[model samples]
Target chain A: DTAVSQTPKYLVTQMGNDKSIKCEQNLGHDTMYWYKQDSKKFLKIMFSYNNKELIINETVPNRFSPKSPDKAHLNLHINSLELGDSAVYFCASSLRTNTGELFFGEGSRLTVL
Target chain B: SQQGEEDPQALSIQEGENATMNCSYKTSINNLQWYRQNSGRGLVHLILIRSNEREKHSGRLRVTLDTSKKSSSLLITASRAADTASYFCAPFTNAGKSTFGDGTTLTVKP
Candidate 1:
């Protein structure tokens, strides 16, 4: 079984549309994060949640929101998606917030045309 | 925003050869870690070296951290085709914030 799993492996939508990507981890991690890898391959941290509490919120647009229903699930919702929003979104989790080792799910590639 | 920056944006090597990638950060950290991302896949943690540690090894991978210089390096020995992937270094702040580098793409020719 996958330690971390994300849904909508590939998402293609028109500009101004809204979409969401779901993630879950079977590892029973206390921290989860959402990272975006742009065309230039820069992995930027968008948000982080620890035990369902928001911990890290980078300089991302307000259109991007992270919802953690529980310690094991973190979902990202994007509103009015733009072409620049197209990128590979990764979901990751760690046993503890301080641990450097993260378990990542197969990325969800989103394309806003 | 990203914290760590890796050198040699890309690297190419033949099987059985060794691949090395370097990363430099701007702030103090509790630990530095390396990760590998295969094409179209999520990144996998390769190794981590604490600020108090100089070097660490796992299988054919070796990682070294120099907290004083705020840099780290990942070395893959006896590289194989399967070893081809983008290697990234992430230095975590004492507050537990982690930022990944741009990554060094390694291509191992069969």
Candidate 2:
């Protein structure tokens, strides 16, 4: 079984277009996260949710919002996407918050023109 | 601000050789974790070393933590081409936050 999965493996959109990426984890983890990996391969943590509660919210712009309907799903929605939004968005989950290993999904690549 | 920053942004070694990557972090940490990411793939957990621990081993991979120096090193023995990937270190603090570094790109040539 796929432990962590993200939908829309690839996304290509124009500037000002809004898009959403969905993520689901079956590991029964209490914490889920959204990370952005830039072209330089630098991974940055965007948001973190523990048991459907917002735990960590970095300095990400308001254009990006993360919603967790439950403990198993966390989705990211970008509004009026800009060119700088082009990168790989990864969904991860762990047994707890700020500790233990993280199981990551295959990642969703977003390319904005 | 970033917590952990790996040294030697990139390393290239031949197969059967040993590769070493170092990570330095600011402030104290509860634990440190190492992860690997292949091209176009997600990061995979490799090992985790706690603050009280000094050394840990998992198969051909060895990790060492020095809390006094605030540094850690990951050593891979008998590296193969398939081992080529970017290695990242995440230093987790007691305040419930961990930040990943830029990562060390290890290229094992066959």
Candidate 3:
């Protein structure tokens, strides 16, 4: 089974447009996360959820919203996408253990022109 | 917003050699993990060492953690061409929240 999977591996759009990235995991993990890795190679966590409930929402802009329909899926939607949103977004899942051994997705590259 | 940082932004070595990367964080952590990212793909979990644990091993990868110093190190023994990738160490704490370092870009010449 593909443990963690993300859709639209590549996205190129103009500024002010809206785009959404989908993520799903079959690992039976209780926690899922969304992370952004920019051109500087900095991976920062944007949001986290456990059991379809919100947990950690970083200091990210309100334009970025995360929706978890169930425990197995988490999706990110960016409204009025700006140039700064162009980065590789990754989705990961773990068992909510203190160890934090996350299984990551292949990433979705978003390029805002 | 302090996070973990890896030493030596890049490294080049020959096949069968050993590659070591060090990571230091600014905050206390419950555990630290190492990940490998090839090209622009997702990160692959390499190994994890808890705060209470001093050392852990997985095949060719060995990880050591020092909670007092708030640092960790990942050692890859007998690195091969296939091992060439960007390695990142993330220290998981309340504030850090499993953050990634800039990563050590490794090039193994076959």
Worst 10 residues of 3 chain A by lDDT: A94-103
**What stretches of model 1 exceed 4 Å from their correct place?**
none
> Highest DockQ among the candidates is held by which one?
1
Considering every candidate listed, which one attains the maximal lDDT?
2
lDDT, candidate 1, A1-113, per-residue tens: 99999998999999999999999999989999999998877898889999999999998999998999999999999999999999999999998887879999999999999
Tens digit per residue, CA lDDT, model 2, B1-110: 34688988999999999999999998988889999999888999999998999999999999999999999999999999999999999888875577788899999999
**What CAPRI grade goes to candidate 1?**
medium
Measured against the true two-chain complex, the DockQ scores of the candidates, in the order shown, are: 0.78, 0.70, 0.66
| CA-lDDT, candidates in order | 0.91, 0.93, 0.89
Candidate 1 displacement at residue B75 in angstroms: 1.1
True contacts kept of 1: 0.80
lDDT of 1 at A12: 96
Model 3 lDDT on a 0 to 1 scale: 0.89
| Minimal lDDT window, size 10, model 3 chain B | B93-102
Relative to the unseen true structure, what is the C-alpha lDDT of residue B52 in candidate 2, on a scale of 0 to 100? 94
- Write candidate 3's Cα lDDT for B1-110 as tens digits: 43779988999999999999899998778778899999978999888787789999999999998888888889999999999999998888754376687899999999
Interface RMSD of each: 1.3, 1.5, 2.3
**TM-score, each model?**
0.97, 0.97, 0.96
The 10 consecutive residues of candidate 1 chain B with the worst lDDT sum are: B93-102
